[model samples]
Target: MIEETPQEVQVVEGVLLAHGIEPRTHWFEASTATALEAAAALGVDVGAIANSLVFRLDEEVIMIIASGAHRVDTHLLGEWLGGIVTRASADMVRRSTGQVVGGVSPVGHPERLRTLVDVSLGAYERVWVSAGHPHAVFPTTFEELLRLTGGTAALVARD
Candidate 1:
């Protein structure tokens, strides 16, 4: 297990503190890079794991916090956003969010990104999200996620 908190995760903790939230971070020995891994490590349903997805809309980068059980339909997302949506390159993801692909948190981006939170996540009372590290995660509610990321609630996933 990683005994030390990563600097990236510390930044996320700082952001959460700035938002008046006490960080409750969980670190795992194995990589919780994927939603399934995170769910397994946390002993929660897959749907309760919030997946932070980065996409490119024209020249802008956007974030979609979708439930682990769902897949973001890029075509539908593009239609809703009035532009085609493509997966953001790893470099773009890192530069825009100041974190690695597997560890991107909803907060602590270089700038405020346009974010969409999947309404499906509302089914769970508590959800787990990445805490800026592949081995770290934090529990949060759907409403809290919306508030923290300034994200609009939407149907971002495919059925």
Candidate 2:
């Protein structure tokens, strides 16, 4: 049975289902706001955490599904995406994804935004991503994310 989902998470769940992916959101008593926190809660490697990050690329808003183990290098990300990349403001984040900073998901936006998938995420068989709520998360695989978002696989971080 599916857990009772908040409206925000329901939007994400619908998107996942529309893509033919079925996943249940796990709600935690504590916050899963950060990748480290989420990984700890799930008892998984940090690399298995998929951080859905929003960025302002030139005039467009984009999403980068990065692995939790490393930080995304905005400079390199811009070069790869062929645009100037900068961190989206709180307002921009909310406006673009209709989700807060800590609860952004790879899908379920008002419109389809350009997305990039960090290649490092492929190292793990399954990854956990925000489920449109800070206290909620859902399981997915790298290939599924790529397929769902129609994202490009790229090296988004620096060592």
Q: Give the winner by lDDT.
A: 1
Q: Model-by-model lDDT, in order?
A: 0.93, 0.90
Q: Write the per-residue lDDT of candidate 1 for residues 1-159, one digit (tens) a residue.
A: 776777888889999999999999998989899999999998999999999989999888999999999999999999999999999999999999999999989988879999999999999999999999988999999999999999999998778
* Candidate 2: C-alpha lDDT: 0.90
Model 1 worst lDDT window (10 residues):
1-10
Give TM-scores for every candidate, taking all chains together and pairing residue i with residue i. 0.97, 0.95
What's the number of clashes in each of the models? 0, 0
The alpha-carbon lDDT assigned to residue 28 of candidate 2 equals 93
Candidate 1 residue-wise lDDT at 123: 96
Clashing pairs in 2: none
